[model samples]
Target chain A: MSPDRPTLTATPHNVGVDAAVAAARRVVTALLHAGDGSAAAMAEVASRLTAVAEHLEEHAPTRDERLVDMWAGEGVTRHDPVTGPENAVAPPLPLSGLPDGSIQGTVTLGLPYQGPPGCVHGGVSALLLDHTLGVANHWAGDSGMTGTLTLRYHRPTPLFEELTVRARQVSVEGRKIRTTGEILAGDAVCVSAEGLFVNKHLPRPR
Target chain B: MSPDRPTLTATPHNVGVDAAVAAARRVVTALLHAGDGSAAAMAEVASRLTAVAEHLEEHAPTRDERLVDMWAGEGVTRHDPVTGPENAVAPPLPLSGLPDGSIQGTVTLGLPYQGPPGCVHGGVSALLLDHTLGVANHWAGDSGMTGTLTLRYHRPTPLFEELTVRARQVSVEGRKIRTTGEILAGDAVCVSAEGLFVNKHLPRPR
Candidate 1:
C-alpha cells in the first residue's frame, strides 16, 4: 500500500582516483538519508557536484579507454557495483574469505537503497547475495559466469542497520559450480539465494 | 578475463531537485566512468564532495524523519534504488505501462554497473527485472512482496548500450501472482526472470 503523500520541498546534493571513494559514497548516503528537501538547496548542491564532475572529466580518459584499463589491473574488483571502491553506486562491500571456504561482509544500507519504506529493496538483497556467491566461487578456486539464480525473501531487511552477507560454494561438477548465499539482519535471514555458475572462459579484454 | 589497468589518478566530484537529481546522477556516472584515478585528484574531489555534503547536512532533516516523510507521498517512487530520481545508485530506468498489462523501459548502463569487463553485472540485471516486475504487478492492480524470483542468465548483458526490460503478469492464484520478464540486447534475450509474489498487506508508515 502507498504511504501518505507529502509535498516535496525539493533539494539536492565518490572516491579518489579509497578514502576519496569512501567519502563519495558517504555523499550519496547523506544526500538520500538527510537531504534538505528544498529545491533551492538541491540546486546549490547540484551545481557544486557538477563543478567537481567537470574537473574530474577534464583529466580523465574516455570511458572505453577506462574500461580497457580497468581490466588491466585491479579495475574489475575495484569498480564493480557491489564491492568496487571506485564505484559510488556500490555499498562497496568488502568481502573476506573464511578458512571454512565462505566469503562474508557487512554493510549498513540507508535511504538510497530503500524499497518498501524503511526496508532494503528486495532486488538489492538479490544483488548482494548474487555477488557474494560469485566471491564464494572465487574463494573455492573457481571462476564462472552465473547461469541461474533463485532467491527467497524471508522477511523485510530494515534500512540503516548493519546486515551480514555470506556465501559458500556447495559443489562443483566439471564446469558447473553451485553456491548458496544469504543476507542476514543480525541472526535472522532476510533473503537467501542459490546459484549455478558455468566455468566457460570468457574473452579477455585487449 | 581482465583488461589492462592504467593506474588510477586521484579525482573527485545532485539535485532539487529534479534538475538537481539529474545533475547528481551525472556526477555519479562521470566519476565512475571518467575519474582521474589519482589519489591526490581523488582526495581533492572527495574534499569538495564532503564540503557539499556537509552543507546539505546543515539544512536537512534527520534520517528517521526523512524516512517517515518519504512514504508521506512521492518519496516511495522517487527514492527507490531502481527508479528513484533521488537515488544516484539507480540507472533510474523509467518504466511505462503497455496496453496488454505489461511494463517496459530502456536504459544504458556504463562502468559503474559492470561485472564482467564490458558487460552489465549479472546481479544488476536481476535488480532491473525485479523492479520492472513489481511495476507490472502494480499495473495489473495487484501488489505483493516478491516471494520468489528465479533468473536465468542466457548471455552477458553488455554495458553502455540501450537495453530493453519488459515484464508481464502471467496468472494469479488466490493470493499468489506469477510474472515473467527479461533483459534484452536489441532483440536477443540476455537474462530472463520469473517471479512469484504474494498478495499480503505490508504495514504502512503513519
Candidate 2:
C-alpha cells in the first residue's frame, strides 16, 4: 500500500496558482530580509497583506475540500511542505528523479530560512532531507510514514547560496523502509540524514 | 562563552513589526486554506501582495543590517524559526522558562506546516523539538550548535490543535550538551527527540 496521503499532494490549478505562490514566497522573503524599523510602514504593509487575505478568502474553497482534491488525482506528489509549489512556506524544491533510483534537487534559501548567523536552520535541513527521502521512496515505488530520523550536522548550511540535496533508498524489509540523504553546500556535505519509514496500513506488533 | 549568534535573535522593533508579521502569516494561512482555482482572482491577489513587498522593500533595511542588530542585544533568544515573532514561518511558539532548568511552549499549527493528511509533517515535528531543545539549553544557561539530532515519531502529530512541547537538559560534558524534547497532543506524546550540541568556542574532536 502506498502510504500516499491527500494533504501532501498538490491541488488542481492552472499555472496561475504557481505564479501566485511564488509571488507570496517572494513577499515572505522580502519581509524577512527588509524592515527599516518604521512602525507606520510596517502597519501599512500589514494592512495591505490583510486585504489580500480577505480577498483570497472570498474567492477560495475551504482547506478541507482542497486537500481532498489534491489526493484524488496526484496521489502523494507535489504540494508537500518541502516541495509543494502551492505552499509559500516552501522553498518548494524542484527535484528530479535519477536513472540510478535516487532523487535530488537544489534550492537557494534566503533570510526567511536562516538560523545560525547566515546558515540554514538545522531543522530546515532535516525537513528537506525528510521530503527528499520520501521522494526517493516514491521513485522506488514504495511509500511510508517517517518512523525515525537521524541527522548529523557536519557544517553550517549557508543562506542565499545554492545547496544540493539528495536522497536514496538504502533497504526495505516488508513494512519498513530505510533511506539516506544529505544536503551539500557545493562539494561540502553540510548535513546528512537517515530515516526509517513504516507503511501506513500495516498492523504493528505491540 | 554563550553559543549566542546574532541571526537567531529578534531584531529591535516596536509592536508594529509583530502585528505585521502576524498579519503576513495570516495571509499565508489564508492563501493555503482558500483559493478556489480561480486563476484571475489568484493573479489579483498576487499583484496586491507584490505591491506590499515592493513597498516594504522601498522603505526597509537590508537583511545583513537586520542580523547585526538582532545579535547586538538579547543574544539567541527570539527571531528563531521555532519561536521568533518577526518570522512569519514560525508558529512563533510561546515558550516559558521553568525553575527546574527546562523550557516549555505551546503552539497550534495550521495548514502551512501540515504533511500527513491531518498531521504535522514529521520533519516539522523535528523542527519543533530541535528548537525546543535549544531553548532547554538556554534555560540551563548554556547554548551550542546542534551537532546531532534523533527523532522517533510515535504517532502522527495532528494539525489545527494545540500541542505542548517541552525540553530539558539531560547532561553537559565539556562542550557537549545533550537535551531531550517531546511534542505532546494533549497527554499523548507524538514525537520525541534527542540532540547533541557543541559549544561554539570549543574545539571538536577530529
**Strongest candidate by DockQ:** 2
Residue A1 error for model 2, in Å? 28
Q: Summarize candidate 1's per-residue lDDT along B111-161 as a digit string, tens digits.
A: 778888789989999998888898788778786999999999999999878
lDDT of 1 at B31: 75
Q: What's candidate 2's i-RMS value?
A: 4.5
Candidate 2 off by > 4 Å: A1-14, A36-40, A201-206, B1-14, B36-40, B75-77, B201-206
lDDT of each: 0.76, 0.77
Candidate 1 has what TM-score?
A: 0.89
Q: B27-146, model 2: which lDDT tens digit per residue?
A: 877777664364337777777877877777776665667777654554554556777777787887766666566777778998888887767888888888887888788778778899
Candidate 1 docking quality: incorrect, acceptable, medium or high: acceptable
